[model samples]
Target: MSKRPINQLSLFTPGLDTDPAVKATMREAARSCALSREQLCDRMNELAGQAGIRLNGGNAKQLTLATLEKWLNPLDREHIPSARAIGVFCRAVGSVEPLQTLVAPHGLYLIDEQQVRKLRMAEIEEEMEALKREKQRLKAGS
Candidate 1:
């Protein structure tokens, strides 16, 4: 398979608005790593449109990292993505250099489905505890 450029793929990343710092980091990664900007933009435009992300609002030529936090993540925002996210955005998901340069530096810790499951379980546990506490308080009052 022919390798697509970095700039092309990075643009499609969901947080065109949410994660600007990461976006700026991605742009720098593209330039330093020699990724294609135009192709990335094209792919980004296509995917973002499907996901209902506005493409033509702010910072036209470049993505602004600061504005990223305002919008909701396309899917789930709680846990950061793992290989799945990389598979969706990166040209090389498993490559060490890519992870070190493109993802890790930006504080995006990749989490697998197992990690997500654990987090969900933890959240459930917390909710259960809260409910139990509320029940105890009601019993005491009664």
Candidate 2:
């Protein structure tokens, strides 16, 4: 007997197209972030409490170690938090490492405050230079 073809809608899920190498790197990063010396679970709990994030319909006090375990454990792919939750966690904890890890495989990086300031400064300098050139050109034309 022949099996029916799967629908296109079912063929594409978020992260389904991620490269294997990238996925492996992300997994390693997740493991590292979860097991860091700072204790990710405790940090998450503290951050969640501070930020008023309710997990699994539970109050801040209800956010348990097991919930964090499910989030951090790379093997528990089925229970990983959504991307938005990851971003919220990172911001609440004042650490972009987790977000950086998640996006590194996609050739992207989340710039820190210092990096952002530097980038903006460079952009402003470039704009100033362009304006200077334009001024010079107009003067020469006149």
Candidate 3:
């Protein structure tokens, strides 16, 4: 029997827009994250009202619908918002979806507050169990 080269197989198709797998994954992420375009816009608008952010060389206390529409439009990929803007949106909405979407392709994940709390609790429980076992072992040896 002869072995086939790995490169001979088709690993990935080039066009993401036309690829069913890519589309399905995107749709699934959006659904699981429960983030709609309207909700995103509303969150962005709410964040824009705060005193710190500046957009396009002007102090925008609030972002206008026109600006937000341009940013949110699927056809306007070239004009998509910056990473900082996405971060602000995530913080404003209390959701990690935007950050996860941005970093997923790079093999990264964004941990939320609830996940952190759970992880910490697990660690504490494990440590307590270990301490109890060690105490028992020392008493037996004595």
Candidate 4:
């Protein structure tokens, strides 16, 4: 597939209020990171380059420290980062907390490979309980 600009504006409603917690999560992620903010942006850009991704407007630079600052700034809602930027930020900082924070308000969550099995087991247990209840109901009716 052909490469597309990563920062295309989609799903944004003008004048809509955004959750402050999203930016707070990003700030916490940055604070917990061992690398400085400049280093973090550099690493994000490097990763984007490796993935053959570029920001919108076909700009060669994927991210910069100033851009990153705007993203983390609570007052600068207009400078929101793209989904791709968030992904790279998570990868660079070695945490999914920001992503988790974004999805939590929607009743969604992120789970790692290790948690998949546990989730499946819980599902299976629920199904078994449902079946047992059905069997008892049938026996009583018979």
Candidate 5:
């Protein structure tokens, strides 16, 4: 019932603050990227191959081409080729922005990326502590 793939969300999204112009810009960038979902997946697969990294199916969810490149070929910087290819693809498609750069500052910074995961884990710990306290209170009441 949707126009796009079932698993895919539209690449174009409104800006964080919900400005129409920003959303327009994002849509423009996604269009410029010039890659379909399948192509992006293959690009990632190719990079993984070059790094000689064997990715298990389960781990694939956690693995991204940029992340894998940063981890596996940190010193060599060979993975840059992949980024450049994507940039060129974007340019050819009339995309004015380096969509990667646009999105990275917002989505994939060292602090923000790590903080959200840490916060979720902290929440889990807090729930466990509350449960433990509740159990003690019940046992004392009896």
Candidate 6:
């Protein structure tokens, strides 16, 4: 019986390489998405609204296609999306590549729930092997 959702693995992509070009990553993520730029912006704004997200100076404004274009533009470094916007964008695009790229340079990596369970299972196996070794040592001493 698991307390967490069984489908959490869908949220993460393990073993993905890092890319330092955040703007390029974002651009690629958006470009590869099934939604058009206008549709993507619409989806981003919809998600932001549902989550009560506000950008820039905290005013309630919907994300515009022009703003998204600026963020996607490599030369327009000044208009990088906010963390909230990034979250919304990732959700809207159905890909975490942009977020993963941002975190990779910081020595952080994303792992799925299945990977975490596998690691824990391996650790427990190691502990069991250590106990077996101790049992053998005890029998020899007896």
My TM-score estimates for the predictions, one after another, are: 0.33, 0.59, 0.52, 0.73, 0.26, 0.77
Question: What tens digits encode model 3's per-residue C-alpha lDDT throughout 1-142?
Answer: 9764533433342332322332333334444555565675566666655636643335755555566555545555444555556556556556566556555444456787899999999999999999999999999999
In candidate 6, which residue pairs get closer than 3 Å at backbone N, Cα or C atoms, i.e. clash? none
What's the distance in Å from true for residue 16, model 3? 14
Between candidates 2 and 5, which one is better according to lDDT? 2
Whichever of 1 and 3 has more lDDT, that candidate is 3
**Residue runs of model 1 more than 4 Å from their true location after superposition:** 1-107
Candidate 2 off by > 4 Å: 1-39, 57-61, 83-94, 103-108
lDDT against the true structure, per candidate, is: 0.46, 0.58, 0.56, 0.76, 0.48, 0.78
Clashing pairs in 2: none
lDDT of 6 by residue, 1-142 (tens): 8564543433354423332266778899998999999999888988888998774444547777888898888777567787778788889999888887777644466777999999999999999999999999999999
- Of 3 and 5, which scores higher on lDDT? 3
Ranking by TM-score: 6, 4, 2, 3, 1, 5
lDDT of 1 at 111: 71
Candidate 2 lDDT over 24-130, as tens digits, reads: 44345545554452465566556666777654443444446666556656556556665655755565445566666666544566787999999999999999999
Q: After superposition, how far is residue 112 of candidate 5 from its true place, in Å?
A: 4.3
Candidate 1 — which pairs collide?
7-40, 8-39, 8-40, 17-68, 18-68, 19-68, 20-65, 21-65
Best by TM-score: 6
Worst 10 residues of 2 by lDDT: 7-16
Better of 3 and 4 by TM-score: 4
The candidate that wins on lDDT is 6
RMSD in Å for model 6: 9.6
Candidate 3: 10-residue stretch with minimal lDDT: 13-22
| Model 3 RMSD, rounded to 1 decimal | 8.4
The Cα error of candidate 5 at residue 6, in Å, is 26
User: TM-score for model 2?
Assistant: 0.59
Task: Summarize candidate 1's per-residue lDDT along 29-132 as a digit string, tens digits.
Answer: 44553435555545544555565544445465422232222221333344232332323334422223334444543345557689999999999999999999
